[model samples]
Target: MVKGCSLSQNGSSSFPDPLLYRQLVGRLLYLTNTRLDISFVVQQLSQFMASPMINHHKTLTRVLRYLRGNPGQCLYYPENSPLHIKAFSDSDWATCPDTHKSISGYCTFLEDSLISWKSKKQTTISRSSSETKYRALALASCEIQWVTFILEDFQLHYTQPALLYYDNNSVRYIATNGVFHERTKHIKIDCHVVRECLQKKLFHLLPISTHD
Candidate 1:
């Protein structure tokens, strides 16, 4: 909702003070831990805290009203799920306006329950959709490593290869194959790391329809 804010101010005197505006934005950001739906909205509001106007305040208030109307909303997980680990990853190609950096997002699940998730902008620009997907896969692999260690701590063993699902077929092929395409040479480390995981039989990559 904060993304709907318009920077309309009648005059300079009508604008809210920067410090107070930032303080409010900070509080909203803190609330995002239990409210994942508000993360995108909070992040948008934070960007305009420096010189907020009445229009920006309107947008912020709308977000607050939304929360007030849905106070009981919370993430719930069911027990008695299977022990198998699975992950899904994807990347938006050059979604950022300023840097042309892609955003990598992945969600890990232990059966029906979501165990881990991440949404981060890539540090470098990717030249192809396959490269964007590769970066996302690398991030998902790191998450799998961490989760595997935690499971080992509990004396639970995952004998089967950890399943990683990707919607992009090109990236899946690249992961299963050792040869690198010309477009992917820029991120050689990512290619090597994913290839190594495949060889070690630590994880398995699978293709899933985008609809899934």
Candidate 2:
């Protein structure tokens, strides 16, 4: 999807073949298991499956073209990988122009090999970007815990705190500074998983450049 571009059910002619659109999108959904690059775009297009529009079809075609042009792109797991856990989580606040809801995404890596990831729309309306980032971080924390369980099953464990990168400094303060809690009262209590994880040494928060 184009940066700053928002798609909606309005202002477009409906696609002529809804079934074909659905089929193509279903294939794209399956491909997301390996083609992580297209996950966000597939999520956007899937929203209009019931009433797909011409613009949606055009976007889907572009994704397909990109995939065809880069068939070699795929998940690669290298040999002799170390037992390291790291993750990156982010959110686009109020990205859905029609609903004003946010989208959160996170991807985890074990020794530089991608393992788990997700892209989903937030259920509640977020009043601020900080709240959205907190939500995304909370979800990513849970995913990291799940990955830890898998590692334990292999008789392995990450001795160091999992490095979690986010693009917001406020989030780091919220998780690290107790005084920061007073300012974050507006944020929901459930969104403070980062704080708990930090105290328990489950993960270490790091600021990352948005462009990265």
Candidate 3:
């Protein structure tokens, strides 16, 4: 349901009655607590909750229809799965229609089960692809730290330097090396934080080819 809504529309609500729309959207957000599959879609819908338009309502209806059709479909965590933690992250460049801030999204898994994830609009507008990718890495770094803390609470020990997999080599390079090109000077904060995390051995970015 929420999955369909997320895949069906980009941001920018096309509907009306923003107050009512936001109320409904809020319900969806609340529902995401137990519905990890809907997290991405709920996050997408949340972006338009402020000033929903007619199109937004239509999109929301589509999500409802999808939910109606697949009420039984939901994420399942295996009881016997191992406690190993791993994370994957991706970002879209300048995805916002208004401010042009990129959207950073990532999902964390405990063995085969998803534990946490988010899709959010970045605070600073990025000037290039590298900046957006770096922002996503930094955001993922925060998630890694939280997950590590959670693991510690449970008395589970994940090896130091949690693995973070990304598809972009340039982003990987920025984290692995400190060479500051003129293009990435504007994104100094993101680069610095990511590098710091890397240096601390809190997480290491693993390069994966796009097709792989």
Candidate 4:
């Protein structure tokens, strides 16, 4: 779970027992269902299931140590929280040393309470940071739309254009700008779903400093 730590399948001996590593990673994956903080790290560890290495085991132990040190930590929701929806999305572009795939992470809030979150690697490699970020935004937007539908089913209505925060200005520009350029044409058509949501006033994209 160390910040800026990138794991790879290079320059390390294979673990003697890959089964143990797989079992441990499976448990960690289950933990991520509630432990959003560990989701990214667990996703990174899962990539080595086919052949885990010594360094991977070391990193897994570190995650276990982190869990031990923070046994009481958990996501909490308060009763009577407001029904407004907001989301934050980000991606680490081409961070996977083996496949060179990007990792996307997003968290959704019902007012001030965290309600949903995810961390997963992109299926296809992104050629630019903007593309990677835009893909992340698209994923977050889809989740927001689903959440909005569920809320409606329960008779909870929120204001139009739910707020979505991203650190990439280019992505915000792409979502709002109608024109497409050669640089953006290569991006998958499915990823443009965010722009459709924007056109429908489903969500407003805002730029934020990465440190924020």
**Per-candidate total of colliding backbone pairs:** 0, 0, 10, 0
Cα lDDT tens digits, model 2, 3-80, are 766889987999999999999999999999998899999999999999999999999998999999999998999987
lDDT of 3 at 129: 84
Assess candidate 3 and give its TM-score to the true structure: 0.83
Which structure is stronger by lDDT: 3 or 4? 4
Cα lDDT listed for each candidate: 0.76, 0.87, 0.76, 0.86
Report the alpha-carbon TM-score of model 4 versus the true structure. Answer: 0.93
Model 1 lDDT at residue 99? 64
* Model 3 lDDT, full chain set: 0.76
TM-score winner between candidates 3 and 4? 4
For each candidate, give its TM-score against the true structure: 0.76, 0.93, 0.83, 0.93
In model 4, pairs of residues that clash are none
Per-residue alpha-carbon lDDT of model 4 for 145-169, expressed as tens digits?
Answer: 9999998898877666788999887
Which sections of candidate 2 miss by over 4 Å? Answer: 209-212
In Å, residue 173's CA in model 3 sits off its true spot by 0.4
Model 4 misplaced stretches (Cα beyond 4 Å): 181-183, 188-191, 209-212
lDDT over C-alpha atoms for residue 2 of model 2: 73
| Regions more than 4 Å wrong, model 3 | 1-16, 181-183, 209-212
